[model samples]
Target: MTGTATLLHHDGTEEIPRFLGAPGAALFGCLHRPAGVARSLVVLCSSIGAEWKYNYRREVLLARRLAERGVAAVRFHYLGSGNSDDGSPDFAALVAQARQVEAWGRAESGATRVGYFGARFGALVAAAASADTDMPLTAWGAPGTGAGYFRELLRIERVGRLAEGSAAFAEAEEPRVRLARGEPADVVGYPLPPELYDSAQSLVFTELAGTAPRDVCLVEIGGDGSARRAAESLTERGLRVHASRLVEDRSWWLHDADWRPDETRQTVRNMIEETVDWFLTVLPT
Candidate 1:
């Protein structure tokens, strides 16, 4: 995990692709540094599974935009995903890794404040990690409860099982699969641990109250009553919450094959613009 950070030059920015601290399984990160002094440092955490893959371009675009606005950004693959080494994937550990990257961003860019922006599953991770700190947060399309999210995950896995056929069933006969209580051995192409699924099975949105940051801007890709209610609850819990229902209707995770890339790109731009506008209003200039 301890290797020299390679500085790669990009348009009007410096990109450093490095392996973060791991004894054997190093986490991969690509830090985007602004050409001038940065106003703040932000860490981008991606959702699990297909959302992460589909929305990667959007994340890169946002990082570039943030750099242009004097915000240093780092996009990292969480443990067991992307270029990162394979390790046990759990929600709690992902949160800790995000915090570690946040600290790294503060040190690398010499920024005073560190903020987090996470999408889907990463939104939960961002919320959990930044709760004790004074940092601002932007959470997009976060589930109101863990059970709901877990159900969706299982459904996805079932579809994958049907597609993969009898070979997948044979794999399911393994002893650990039976003991894991229906926790997926793998979701799509991602191998999931039983502990990760168990942790997610009990996730409730209200639990975020215990570990919320001072300010949060809750965003939903499509309007949902549950998301709005979660925002209201957060407000009552003493955290400043701004809830908005964004009109980006493309479901990056559940869309059909006929989905248009141009439409998705536009939706991503809309989300990014909304988030940047909110950050500009609250974050110190």
Candidate 2:
């Protein structure tokens, strides 16, 4: 066994499922190690709620593909999500978690470097993390700010509730929403505590004062060009940025039954290819 972790599985590659961070509140993580020497290790951050449910398959595929390319990868649950312990996942703790996981991946795999790849809300977390630490990063479908994300979550929740019935709101008590204050807000089946909201409201990427990672890539799923704008903004801040766009007809983050099997598979393939290719291109010769 590597370190004190248990070997969870061994199909084509070895998977280590373990807990990390301070005792009594450990975050669950699955580390995928290559059969040979790893080129690098990357932590894949996930979006929350329904997005998380739909994107799990894609993330798993990406991890396996990375392992096949001789790169170690980690897919972990944030403090309060998935298999992790119950606790409010705040921005500070998330940033710290990314940094710590990066360091741990480097140590565990003996890789020359460690990087990050985040999707949706996870992309924002990755960007904020880049401001705190220097590392190669890939942000896919990232928003401009945390407050915007908070609003999006609320919108999603409202739409979901409305689909049930018009009288739903009238009969049921709603979760009180507050910004910049520590309060419990349950949006779309996820319990978000006060610190998370307070920190999220202040996360404006363009307004951030810290420097981003030197190597960065921003990808947009469709033609909105938010990723392009973010790339340009980061370039203006003196950070090298690469941008790309992929065609997506609908929101893959949603749990809609409208997705065609072939189209969904192709979309996931495009994302994995673009992400892995960028990592390979940026590696030092």
Candidate 3:
């Protein structure tokens, strides 16, 4: 499996479609529905800004592997990302949307158990969504804190300014810069709407939704120890959660410039194997 093109398979052990899921919504996704009997169904959650441009290929391979292993999987784009609808839906709405997809998966696939596989912001969304649904499920690479990622994104944006060689802008005494009568400002791309931005700005880790004995496998893709911290917090709350680093995921697929955007590799398979063992064996159903 490679890209969405590769996702358009209908043969046994291949991804299929159920366009009947959400009628008015315009999300782009593929369902690797079961050919024979399925043991479980999984919905994959992606990052904010998606990272879908770079990570979609990897997800395709992962979804296919899950399907091949008898776990029917659904990989879809959230609102405002990919072929999804306009940039209007907020984070909570996105969670509901995922649940909507999950409902469809259950109705159509007849899965005995349902689960989630998330990456980055998707992890946070998955956690929130699972908390809302009364489903016994598993989470992978779940993010407990949402606003923390936004702060890091702001830092990345600042560094991006420096990379463009704008010393005056970079060395400015403060972050906020007012309009100068003799100077000017350029908005290269302000495509993002304020609704999403404000929502992301105020997000925090909390037990707002319902609780389940979740089996969480934290995939740390960054050097930061936030994954560990999140695991500790969840455990303290009495949730069955554990954090583990896919040590080379960041080195190979995360960094910019060197990312081989459209290749299927063993890294994804390795990740699935580790998480499956944790979710299927160690974590309670």
Candidate 4:
């Protein structure tokens, strides 16, 4: 609800940057409008912390590619993350924000059909938000449960400490204790609020309410099979699920100094191509 300027791309698509939601809780986003009429709209939800930073370029590319194919896409930063407002939002709040973004994208583009495409932790948000809405969803490299993802953060912190010559493995639970004590802890340079930590521990994809959706496309990067069981669970619940795996380096987890975009060029291209193709088949024309 704040931006007013529109940036026109060479492809005749326009990128409109704006803030949505209430004044203090406004979320920053960019709307990629196609050259002419749009057939569908996609809300692109990003991962938190370093994943968000590393995948930022790919999300922009995905939006632009969708626009080129006559589809409108909206990419946004969750409240308290990225360019959005400064209030710490828990996992549930992030899910609500995703729903709000999808609604706003539909209204703003006048596109009757909408879909969600989320990466990493954002995949959890998309799955939770798509509940009962019957929208198509695509999750890339999603964890099976929030608790697992939270533990990974702690592992990363421990590794960092070890690399810095600090014997902190024995105190690996310090961050969890801090959160349990109603305090904030820093994880991989991002502040993790106690409320968010608590909510994350309770978020289980297989047990989420209203798990039904139009369909789901699960793309696993690095062939780790982390999302395989979750995809199978959705299938068991009678949801249409298509799952695939791609072997690639885990560039999303790398530090800025260690990340090299060229190495993952093929992976990014394949992901966007597959996502756009899948959306075309699942969403109403």
Candidate 4: which pairs clash? 1-19
**Candidate 4: what lDDT?**
0.80
Predicted structure 2: lDDT: 0.75
Candidate closest to the true structure, highest TM-score = 4
Worst 10 residues of 4 by lDDT: 249-258
Query: Which of candidates 2 and 3 is the stronger one according to lDDT?
Result: 2
TM-score of 4: 0.91
1 or 4, greater by TM-score: 4
lDDT of 1 by residue, 1-285 (tens): 354655655556677777888556678887888888776877898988777887777788787778777788888998878988887767788878888787777777777877788887887787777777778888888887766876777677676676789887566544235427755465656666776767777777557544644778888767666568888788777788888876644565655766776335666678788787777666654
TM-score of 1: 0.85
Comparing 2 and 4 by TM-score, which wins?
4
lDDT per residue (tens digit) for residues 212-255 in model 4: 64688888877677668877788878888888987855444454
Question: What is the per-residue lDDT of model 3 for residues 255-279, given as tens digits with 9 covering 90 to 100?
Answer: 5555554444466667767766654
Measured by lDDT, the strongest candidate is: 4
RMSD of 3: 5.5
- Order of the predicted models by lDDT, top scorer first: 4, 2, 1, 3
Worst 10-residue lDDT window, candidate 1: 170-179
**C-alpha local distance difference test of each model:** 0.74, 0.75, 0.60, 0.80
Tens digits of per-residue lDDT, candidate 2, 199-263, equal: 77878755442275477888887887788788788888877788888887777677656765533
Tell me the lDDT of model 4 at 285.
42
Off by over 4 Å in 2: 1-12, 132-134, 174-182, 206-213, 259-264
Q: Give residue 121's error in model 1 in angstroms.
A: 1.1
